[model samples]
Target: MSQTPRYQEIRDDLLARMCDGTYPPGSLLPAEPELAEAYGVSRPTLRQAIQLLADAGYVEKRRRRGTVVRRRKVEQRFMDALMSYGADVEAQGAIPATRVLQARIQGASPEVAEALGIGEGDPVASLMRLRYLDEEPAVLLRTWVPTSVFPGLLGHDFEREGLYDVFAESGLPVETVRRVLEAALPDPVEAELLAIDEGQPCFLFKSVGRAKTGQAVEYSVALYRGDVNTFTVTLTTED
Candidate 1:
């Protein structure tokens, strides 16, 4: 048989080592020259293999730290269904909890009002929460909901469950949601709340949920630690 693809071979070998615990989390791997020599491949080829691992979220290359194994990937299911953040964590067998940092009725900003389809002066329930996964602060959530739709929602205890769960309990018809993900440097407040170092990069998610009647109900911005959480999406093609 023809020789296995070079990159594939290199990738498989490194992955096997990782799986067998040769390189545990936060452990550094061999340098480029050393890896190339051991793999009997050129430096460029070995570099490509390392890049592949980095893209798969298995390793991180720091300028001075060399290449180190990253923490295990968190599985994220992306189905065409509505699920709460708390429920999602529980499904993965991880303990989920939230610390409500702020909750009150506030006049909707122009941007928030437009997203929630409410007047600018309308009252909106604003909440800030720090979500923990397995005792680690994982995400910082800032959410706004139109008070006209669910009065007194700001008084509920969101530390025990997600806002989406409360909305479902109230018989709100949550039909669809739109989400966008991007990388950003955490602001001072966000960095402090998420327990990340100042100016660290994070994955920012902006999402809007709407009722079946096409009324926008929720507008939220969430910041997740890049080193701890990864957002995943699956797509199928129609021929």
Candidate 2:
């Protein structure tokens, strides 16, 4: 067998430590230089090893605190009935909360327009929020709804309510949803909002929700922290 790359070897060792409780969850690993010296590798190589841990949801790189063993990721099953982030987390025995960052009427971008089946530049209610699970930053969520579908949407308080609830209150029934999932590195803004090191991996979920009559009601994009959230998809075979 080919030799394991030096960085992978280091990463495996650290992962072993994490699994054995040598580095317990929420506990810090040794400082970078010390770890580097122990592994007989350059700091850059050590960092690569650490980055691998972070990307795999095993650890987090926090400023001033060093690398920390992460808690087990919260599992999000895509096959579950569509619900609010709060509901999803609560069902998993975690507390869920939201902090609205921005909520206002704005012109839809081309992407939003396409998703919502509206004209480009049409009026839409845009909402941005930072969602938390057990008081830890977990997801950065942005959603757009056509003003024509729900007028005065901006007048509602989203920090204490969920977008799905808002839609229901407006008598808009979501008939279908199409979603796309991908992995990406957080941009500077996302990194700041999520309290994660810049360039850390995140799970991006983008969806368009339509009303019963085929009118698109919502266009949403959510970024889940890679180190703390994992999604599962279930498939069934026909008899």
Root-mean-square deviation per candidate:
6.5, 5.7
Error of 2 at 134 (Å): 1.3
How far residue 165's Cα lies from its native spot in candidate 1, in Å, is 1.8
Expressed as tens digits, the lDDT of each residue in 78-115 for candidate 1 is: 33456777777788777778999999999999989888
Model 2 error, position 233 (Å) = 1.2
TM-score, model 2 to reference: 0.76
Task: Report the lDDT tens digits of candidate 2 across residue range 1-239.
Answer: 89889999999999999889899776889999999999999999999999999998788778766888888778886545677677777888888889999988999999999888889999999999999877778899899999998988888888887777877878887878889989988988999888788767899989888888888899989998988888777778899
Q: TM-scores for all candidates?
A: 0.69, 0.76
Q: Which stretches of candidate 2 lie over 4 Å from their true place?
A: 1-65
- Measured by lDDT, the strongest candidate is 2
Worst 10 residues of 2 by lDDT: 77-86
Which residue pairs show collisions in model 1? Answer: none
